[model samples]
Target chain A: MGTRDRIVAAADQVINELGLVRATTREIARAAGCSEALLYKHFSRKEDLFLAVLLERMPALTPAVTRLSGQVGFATVAENLEEFARAAIAFYRRSLPLSAGLLAERSLLEGFRAMLAETGGGPHLPIMMLGTYLRDEQKIGRVGADADPDAAAALLMGACFHRAVLAALVDLGPDDKAPGFVATLMAGLGPR
Target chain B: MGTRDRIVAAADQVINELGLVRATTREIARAAGCSEALLYKHFSRKEDLFLAVLLERMPALTPAVTRLSGQVGFATVAENLEEFARAAIAFYRRSLPLSAGLLAERSLLEGFRAMLAETGGGPHLPIMMLGTYLRDEQKIGRVGADADPDAAAALLMGACFHRAVLAALVDLGPDDKAPGFVATLMAGLGPR
Candidate 1:
């Protein structure tokens, strides 16, 4: 990888380990086997470096969410939900530290808001896509015709995010419990 | 309030405004109008002060939650949900600063975990209370008997918390959309 890429990767590692508060340019330079000047040559500030790291990492999550959405039609709603649940669990497990750090940093939110304005927030984008899918499902009578697709989409996505946060924050064992949680949620909201 | 209480409250305000990293004991003591030594007399460390502030704020949330739950049969589920939604919105609005600060501090999850442990973290308390009302409705054929009370409880509570967090983080408007969100979720999950 290029020096810029290495610096960004090192910043991500440092941020994950020591948190954004303590992830200094010097530490990142050390991690990348470079001088602090070289690090600053690529990024103007620590915040810029952090944003670059987030942008780099976010693309990895998009495909996973897209893949899960594609798998929705292959099985029953409950099964599809279980698949989504598992995917969410895996995604959060990998991204928790960074996600947690970002959530903890208000300045990061400014950067993220700018990124969202530019590229659409990676996490929120999936929910919008899922909203469209849910609208289609409602029209097809797979979901209740009376159901507000936008609201349903928000609920489904919100529930998944909430569950993932809970799992990451609390020590919920990774048995089939998550899948079961998703299944139960699906049952609660499934076609009556 | 006592000097110790003032110090803790000052710490809470500072942390809420400037975040945990930036909120120093000196700043807190200044805000409290007390000497740093006096501040230190009450809490040995920053973590302890933070925890104390959180504990002071935490008790307020539970009583509000319980009060909402008790309103179950006194009003229609929809009516109760609407009232709960409004209360929840107000609660979250007031708590948003604290929530944002906690997230920024990266200590919310830890505090939440501690709180949950002390309060008995299980599906039972919330489930049982809401389930009783749901069950009563189902027995009267208001809700479908096939509905899973546990699942329904999770859905209702989850939707409320999810909407609250979203409202706190994003501008969903002053209409208090939680009721609409909850209503739609209920419609999706309610008796056909």
Candidate 2:
């Protein structure tokens, strides 16, 4: 593997073990078998490295959500939503620890927010994308006419996100309910 | 206020400002105008003080949820749930920062789990209570027989939790959709 990939892999391991707040860049470099200077040469900051690890090593919902806009009229809405909800729950479980660290400290939260501002990236991205997809479905007369796209998006994503949050806070083994949740929601969201 | 109440209030302020993990007992005692000995006398542990703050200072969903089971056949299901959802959302927003610090460090999380075990207290209590309430409603035929109460409870509380989480992570002012979300879910959960 190349230097960048090696560094990201090392970061993924270190962060998962020590969490995002406690995982030092020095330790990550040592894990990667590289010096701190070399690590800095590849990534501008620790946050950049963390972001790379999240994107490269973790399951991301962005790809699936992006693909959803194209499936507006092809499949049943319930089936499509259940698939998306399942993928989103998995993504959230992986990403929560990485992001939870940002909330633990004030400066870290601000720095992370600033980084997101620079990159035009934040947690709101997925919700916005999902809302747009629902809107597209609405245009095709697949989603109900009076459904609030933004509210529906928030509810769907929020449910998935909460399931991950609960699992992280406590032991919720085999408590997966994404499919049933989607089914119940789709029943309410059926075309008018 | 008495010494115990004073300590609890002071701990609330300190924990809110410095977060739960960083707020030292010394700082809390100083804020309360009491010696560390006096603080320790009043509260055996910092976690106890944090719990007191959560139960005493912050809004709690327990009372609302507890009252819900008694109201099974009284009001419209949608209205009752919307009220509960709003309260849960508000409670989650207040309690999130306090609980989030525990997840940042491994030792803190372990300490918290141990504390919860001793007290038989954890995050699952609300979901269990809500699920029981839903079952009561199902018995009265106010809720559909096919509905999964546990899943419904998780989705309802989870959506509220995620709304708070999202707002904490980003700027989402006036994005409150608890009423509409309840309306949508209730449409699916109506009596068969």
DockQ values, each candidate: 0.33, 0.40
> Poorest 10 consecutive residues of model 2 chain B by lDDT?
B183-192
| Colliding residue pairs in candidate 1 | A104-B103, A104-B104
What DockQ does candidate 2 have relative to the true complex? 0.40
lDDT score of model 1?
0.60
Give the alpha carbon lDDT tens digit for every residue of A95-183 in model 2.
77777777766666777777887887877788788889887877877777766676677777887887776676566678558777876
Cα deviation of B51, candidate 1, in Å: 4.4
Docking class of predicted structure 1: acceptable
Which residue pairs come into collision in candidate 2? none
Lowest lDDT 10-residue stretch of candidate 1 chain A: A183-192
Give me the runs in candidate 1 sitting further than 4 Å from their true place.
Answer: A44-48, A58-60, A69-73, A175-181, A184-192, B40-48, B55-60, B89-144, B156-175, B189-192
| Candidate maximizing TM-score | 2
Model 1 chain B scores worst on lDDT over the 10 consecutive residues at: B96-105
* Fnat for each predicted structure, in order: 0.16, 0.40
Task: List where candidate 2 sits over 4 angstroms from the true fold.
Answer: A188-192, B35-38, B41-45, B188-192
